[model samples]
Target: MSRRYHRKSRQFMIGDTLTIPQDKPDIEFLLRMTAVPTIDKATGADKKVIFSGHVLVTIEYVACVPDGTQPIHFVSFEQPFTGAISHRSARPDRSIHLKGLMEVQELQLVGPRQVKTSLQLKVCSVKLVRCRSPLPTHAGEA
Candidate 1:
């Protein structure tokens, strides 16, 4: 029998964070990666160093509110994402943080009865924080 690619009605969101897991398919999910500079070292002065690396972005899900009672710290937590990355060398357990605009390639389904789903996302958020980004506090907090 021939297989068909029909994406289920999944929820994908876009924000400063990666939402969905690496095993979910969402629409409009992405994170574009790029390199930028920061005023870390100023002629010998110690400054806040900015990190630019590749980030794995995926829209897991969205939590909408009837009333607009959102907080600043709660914004990035709403729309979540998971950053996928590739390291340069000698780095076995690390990957560059992704920062930029995430692009939504398309939704893909694996099985007929919806075995699994995958979303094509591009990382597009600035590498503000460099860490594993645990699922607990990882969503959208880029």
Candidate 2:
């Protein structure tokens, strides 16, 4: 007797344009991705098919603080974001390619104590390839 097996191929793509805003005028800003994984806090067993990553945002600007008025200051922080994609499982074998572009949309100052900025984040592409192994392995064997 023999069993029937299926061979399937799936290619998922993700694309979007994001409008980001800031409270202060930043001369420059840099975004760095820290980690990418499956099953973010927002999606759990819902079949929503979501992907998430940790981003580090660094901003350089001028601000006035209680200590004194500074001409330049550097601020850095981490943020987590989630994006929807075609339903797929997050596994080691799965191939994921992510790319993004950032640009300054608008910049203004509300008052002497406050600054406003608008940023645009364009997600060029996020591609994932789903595949499976045909063999089984035991825990004790390598």
Among all candidates shown, the one with the greatest TM-score: 2
- Model 1 misplacement above 4 A: 1-77, 90-97, 105-120, 124-142
Give RMSD to native, each candidate. 17.2, 12.2
Tens digits of per-residue lDDT, candidate 1, 47-90, equal: 22222222232223222234544321111112224333322221
* TM-score: model 2 vs. ground truth: 0.38
**Scored by Cα lDDT, where does model 1 land?**
0.27
What tens-digit string does per-residue lDDT give for candidate 2 at 71-92?
A: 5755544445556544334444
Error of 1 at 38 (Å): 17
Candidate 2 lDDT: 0.37
